[model samples]
Target: MVIRSRRLSKDNTYYALKQKIIDSELEPNQAVNEENLAALLGVSRTPLREAIQRLENEDFLVRQPNGRLRVASVTIKEVEEVFLIRSMLEGYIARSAAKHATDKDILHLTTMMERIKHSFQLGDKQDFVSYGFEFHDYLSEISELRTFEKVLNQLRDHSLRYCRYVSMHGDWNTQADEEHNYILQMIADKNEDGAEKAMRDHILSSLSTALARIKGMEENEIDHIGP
Candidate 1:
């Protein structure tokens, strides 16, 4: 494949590679072949190596003792850790949203949630997952706090790996829609405590659901291994 590296400076390359990891194109636990990725990105090995190193430092990639780079797996334990932190950060943001969200912002959020709801009803799993993620992101935007925004983005980036593999095929999207809408209403009404609880519960609920799914898959894998 011809890789186009145009318009990519150092910062862009690093983030692009980072996003690719999140997108699962460069899937979890997969090796990172520097020479090939450099060719693929149409850049020299130097910039690619730099990006890889950055990803490594960020815990997004792991350099094996043999000097091979691998995508970091999102383990069940890691998922719990990430969401625990995210719940706290976003719980505060939701409280802030309740205190600060304007009618216009709530209206926009309602519209976006409805659009995602429609996509879910239409059985567009990819769209459902995408919208689910974007919905939380929009809520962070509602907080109007730059620090929260940055931290939230990092949290989102960490969770996004599982998102690519996350099945949006269930009725979960509808549940998510209901949850987000409730959160939005609380924020609009400036019910700070309600908003915080709703958002925190939502995060915990989803994480539980995801963990269950991962556990089920693991069980299936073990069953297969036995045969």
Candidate 2:
């Protein structure tokens, strides 16, 4: 029982730290103080070190030249790599969804679309993104490819940091909504090719905008890689 409790505590510490990095609460390239974090989390150094090691293994944190751990910073190379992979995989998943989705699945996606639109109207960017994830998850689930869904879940989370970055600097929400509408329409029509194309186009377009904004920031001597 003691062993199990320690393991649970370690797992909780891992996820909490991972969430802080993912949500950009910790900020990219921000130095991590192990002692300070241990105090903040109300955990001892042992469990905190274990959790930090796990996050480092997962590429969410990196060791700097000074041997300090910092959240991994975004770069043009990473943006290109992540979006390229996501476009291909998500496109395939969208195609599979169109081919296999039932009436209920279609209705569920439609309802999610409405919720996303409402969120946008209310300027609730977080809710809009959350509902969009729900829509994607449902589509992937209906595709009946468990392995693909697992890969996509990680890819989407990493890509979301960039998505939120774009939203902060541009009017990407409406563009994404328009693209989503096209993808959803294709899925509803069971047009596998069209659905795949729409999904790929959406991802590539998003990548283009994010890259442009990053370039602009670099030119202005401001690195916008953090929240």
Candidate 3:
């Protein structure tokens, strides 16, 4: 029981730290103080160190030359790469879903779309983002492609980080809504090619938006540092 408890503690610590990084509560490249973090997370050094090691392995944390740790920085290249991979994986999944989805799946997705739209209308960006993820996840679930789903899950946290940045700095307006609706329509129509293309286009559009925001952020930082 003691060993099991310790394992649970480590797992909890890892997830808590990961959530902070994903949510940008621990901003990119922010320095990590072991003692302070251990205290803040209400865990001992052993579990905290275990968590940090795991994050480092996942590329969510970086160890500096001086042995300090910091949250991984979000880069334009990383964003592009992640989104490109997501586009391929999700596009395939969307195609599969269109081929295999039942009527109940279609109804569930339509309901989720309504909730997403309502969240946007109410200016609830957080809920809007959450619902958007759920919408995609459900489609992936219905695809019945467990391997694709597993791989996409690995990228989801990183995708969410960039998505949050975009949501905070840009608008989630009619274009995004239209893109989602179009994807859903293709799925409902059981148009496999259309579903794949629509999903790919939607993801690539997001890449464009994220790239713009990231470039703007870089330029702003440079301006701030200039003479």
Candidate 4:
């Protein structure tokens, strides 16, 4: 019973800290003060340490040369790599979904896409993002590829972090709505090749938008810092 309780505590601590990092509440490259973090999270030191170690292993936290922990900073290289990999993996998933999806699955996906469209019309970026993920998640499920789904789940979380950063910039909603509709159409038509291509193109397009926004942000920061 005691061991089970401790395990639960550790799991809870890990998820709590992970959520903070994902939501940017911790912020990129922010220094972590272990004692203060424990107090802030209301967790004991042991479970907190365990959670920190887990997050570090996941690349959400980094240990500095001086042995201090900090949230990992987002980098263009990481973003490019992550989205490129996602394009490949999710492209394959989209193909699989095309090959396997039922009429019922198509109806569900169409309904979800309607919600996404409504969110876009309402200028509700948050709900648009949420419904968009639901659409992709359903594809992952219908793909029936357990291993691919597992890997994509982790990549999706990383993508979420970047999406949150750049989602407000540019004509993200317009581009996303069009791309998502195209992808959905390809899947509904059972065009496996087209679905794969559409999915890959969508992800790579997202990468382009993210890179542009990040570069613009960096340039603005440089401008602010210069004399």
TM per candidate: 0.88, 0.90, 0.96, 0.93
Please provide, for model 1 over 107-142, each residue's C-alpha lDDT reduced to its tens digit, 9 standing for 90 to 100: 888888887878778887767778877777877887
For each of the candidates, the C-alpha root-mean-square deviation to the true structure, in angstroms, is 3.6, 3.1, 1.2, 1.6
Which is better, 2 or 4, measured by lDDT? 4
Candidate 2 residue-wise lDDT at 150: 89
**Each model's lDDT:** 0.79, 0.84, 0.91, 0.89
The runs of at least 3 residues in candidate 2 whose Cα sits more than 4 Å from the true structure, single-residue gaps closed, are 222-227
Candidate 1 local lDDT, residue 81: 83
Which residue pairs show backbone clashes in model 2?
A: none
Ranking of models by lDDT: 3, 4, 2, 1
Q: Candidate 3, which ten residues in sequence have the lowest lDDT sum?
A: 165-174
After best superposition, candidate 2 residue 4: deviation in angstroms? 2.8
lDDT of 3 by residue, 156-214 (tens): 98899878867877677677778889999999999999999999999999899889888
Lowest lDDT 10-residue stretch of candidate 1 = 1-10
For model 4, the stretches where C-alpha displacement exceeds 4 angstroms are 168-171
Across 1-227, the per-residue lDDT of candidate 2 in tens digits comes to 99999999999999888877777778777888898788878889888999999888878889878889888887889989999998898899999999999999888898999998888888877677778778878888898778888888877767877666656655554788888899999999999999999999998987898899877766665544544
